[model samples]
Target: MRNMGGEQVEEAVASAVALLRTATERDWETTPAGRLEWTCRYTAEHVAGDLIAYAGQLAGRATKAYVPFEITLDEGTGNEDVLQVIETTGALLAATLRTTPREVRAFHPYPYRSANREGFAALGVAEVFLHTHDIAAGLGLAYEAPAGLCADVLARIFPHVQPGADPWRTLLWATGRGDLPGRAPVTEWRWRNNLVVPAERLTLQGVTPAAATDLAAGGDGGFAWVEGGPFQGTRDAAGMLLKAYGAGVHRPEWGVFVLVRGEDGRAVGGMGFHGPPDEDGRVEIGYDLVEAARGNGYATEGLRALSAWALEREEVTSVFATTDPDNTASQAVIVRAGFARVAGEDSGSAEGAEGAEQFAYELRG
Candidate 1:
């Protein structure tokens, strides 16, 4: 995806700065910050510290661990000074994001051990919005981040959480800070970064919800594509992803992924599962290559890699696909990936057999 990093970071900081500016004269040191053990003063400093730390990680490109350093307020610094620090540190992060390359990844231990500039930006924004709420709630001042900003952060970092009509409230609930109707209150949570699988000549980069939304709207989905590529099938897959996500049943691991060329990082195709494995331990898979990238075996490589990954999971015992009977090229690609064509009875079909012209293929664990 195109990494809306710099823009998100700046918007989050501006929101916090505006809210905190009104309460600068209050006694922040002794006022407890919501449910936290620390006071409002400490929470404000924490925001600044995180902004600067993320900027440092991106700027230094630390791959193994966090760069061992810290930011501290000067002795006798007041609440106003802390807010200034936040603004300054936030700007630093924004600048760092602008300079960082789109493909550059740094250390961040979550579901994955590394994150790109976009991930860090989303993380930084989450901190600002959540903590600013804590301070605002404690001080009895009203605060609400923009709905669009909340959606961006949730799409980028909180992909596992189902979206709601009110993005701000849903975000707070997902992070254990608030509650939503008909849902259990969150006591603990962790954000998930999208997963990427590597093939011999291509990388199956997982599509984030943000990218899916864009692609569904006929945009480029933040990927650099080879000329005249990202064919209709890829966009259809993206639309499916968005529908599943909107319904709150989307699983990131089972979602669509862009086939990015290893040599140049230009996207050449798309591949993914239809959904999680069904009761019978079977998952349907799909793929498509850009016209310019066709006949290069990219589809076969990606299919093999994704199918293998799915079979590695305990829930998936088999991977299956279907292609038009006349599309011999697609049939050959599936066969080359080690799938056996199911016999003419249409017995292996996932959807009940209504059309006899569609050939079914399967690969067992």
Candidate 2:
């Protein structure tokens, strides 16, 4: 996949990008921001723009080591000329990669630049991976990149790949763009893509359905309809996830939430798993009541049923919760769910990348 003298990979990248970029213009008019959101446009522009930047690096331009850019991007008006730009750039990349000698040290804006054909080829793969996702997501289009290309990106850029994978989860985590506990302590999380992302590097965009319900859950109108998850992030949420995941950032680990909506069934509360799986075969209780739904027993009720189901089938040994120490109301809800505080900081709970301190507590049978 790395050797580039011929035009195969370059042509492939060009063809794929052209179609995706074109579709972007057609779809931009409908989004909330009219221009499909500023970031969307910037990302597409960045794809094209970055190539020019890479060209500079390869040509031995005397510039400072290139800092990686994780800015939000979209295909702006200039993308009207995307086809020519792609064809030209793709060919240039193809030519250089194919002819460039093996031992010549070529520079890439990325810190770990190598001039060999394989290095450029890998960069091509990474560019395609990042750019294609922008175009496809921006256009609300379907995308299935060649598995080989994605593999290259994962391999070559593994160290630089940002936190918060699980594109589905990244939606909320990314969208909220909150300060998280610095590098999540590594946890074993199997992603929908079947990639087990390192725990410390997760980012959230939207709460994913699988992250909440069984990845297999489905139905039209049950007593409770499940929504959100990595798979369903096809909406605005997915974009949010992509922007952050594309750049390394922290994402918190938590669980399967069922949105409890209003009479009209608008989501008013969310109930899901919390706490990392413990040595005792237990994960703590986790729930969120939207502002409108708070002051009720909804959290307690949901926890009661969920706890039993988990214990019976999963053989869970215990559960835990950590809330703001001063949030007496939520504390009451947790207490009602049959959990007792195993620890409470006299100074409150631990201060993490999440900004404020949280009071950590646990519940066991």
Candidate 3:
């Protein structure tokens, strides 16, 4: 539900691979996107290739920002190559940790608004930690993430670290969350959406669950989160999220659901419903979209719809959300969704992750 573990990330990819495999025998070539996105086999190959490519980056002569190097997903190359890339890269980083003096600084080519010289260093540490851990998970192998080894990098980065600030923000002038550079960072986690919609335009009417579909018909240019409709999830899951919103739960108390639909009618993203609809109808909201579909007005739309749905109940008084202060995009969405800042929150260390600082927002009776 939070930071993915190696086992979870691997399970997710395995599921995706299974679906892709079944579709293959049927002669289906499209990715989950339903388009001629990378073929099923190449899709796995590319994922492996992408990892190798990242490892190659850390291994290359260019330590500073540079164009990404290429890695082949050729059939001739076995998965062993992908594993080797990871292991080899791990060895190099380990050596760097043991030998390189902390003062000799280096950087990679990637964007993270929150990433400064110090924050970037944390990101570098996170990069190696996350990717190495994830690849092993994907391959049913085990490995250790010596975050302690890069203690110098962490120390430099930790000071500049604002709670909830992801590595990308530190690395790039850009804001919002997305994938990292030179690494596949996840442990059995299905990467979710990175929506960062503006809050100014978050109007109740504009975010009805069905708005995305209607807009596609009218050809509106802005962004919005459409309903992924009803969904089912593993028991470990609270509701219809994390698995592309598969259908199952549709209780009236569930309120509504939505996805981030681009200008096209296709639902490429999703989020909404903070909890079970209360007797008074109070409920919070959330959204998850893809890497490509971020920074549009989707999160705002989802918030609007959740509010609209809750407001329908006269007994309902308000709704709220907690987010990282550095996650300005999410905060913006919260404000625009008809909630207001009312209180402070505590964002503690990794142990008290949920304790991090949060802004409280509420709607009137």
Best by lDDT, which number?
A: 1
RMSD of candidate 2 to true structure, Å: 19.8
Higher-ranked by TM-score: 1 or 2 = 1
Candidate 2 residue spans exceeding 4 A from truth: 1-8, 21-38, 61-78, 109-117, 159-365
In model 2, how many backbone clashes occur?
A: 46
Which residue pairs overlap in candidate 1's backbone? 2-222
Relative to the true structure, candidate 1 reaches a TM of: 0.93
Per-candidate Cα lDDT values, in order, are 0.89, 0.46, 0.38
- The reply for model 3, stretches above 4 Å from the true place, is 1-256, 260-263, 277-281, 344-353
- For model 2, residues 120-150, the per-residue Cα lDDT tens digits are 5555655555455555665666655555444
In terms of TM-score, which candidate is strongest? 1
Q: How far is candidate 1 from the true structure (C-alpha RMSD, Å)?
A: 2.2
lDDT of 1 by residue, 49-163 (tens): 9999999999999989999999978999999899999999999999999999876778888877778888899999999999999999889899999898888889988888889
TM-score ranking from best candidate downward: 1, 2, 3
Candidate 2 local accuracy as lDDT?
0.46
**Candidate 3 or 2, higher TM-score:** 2
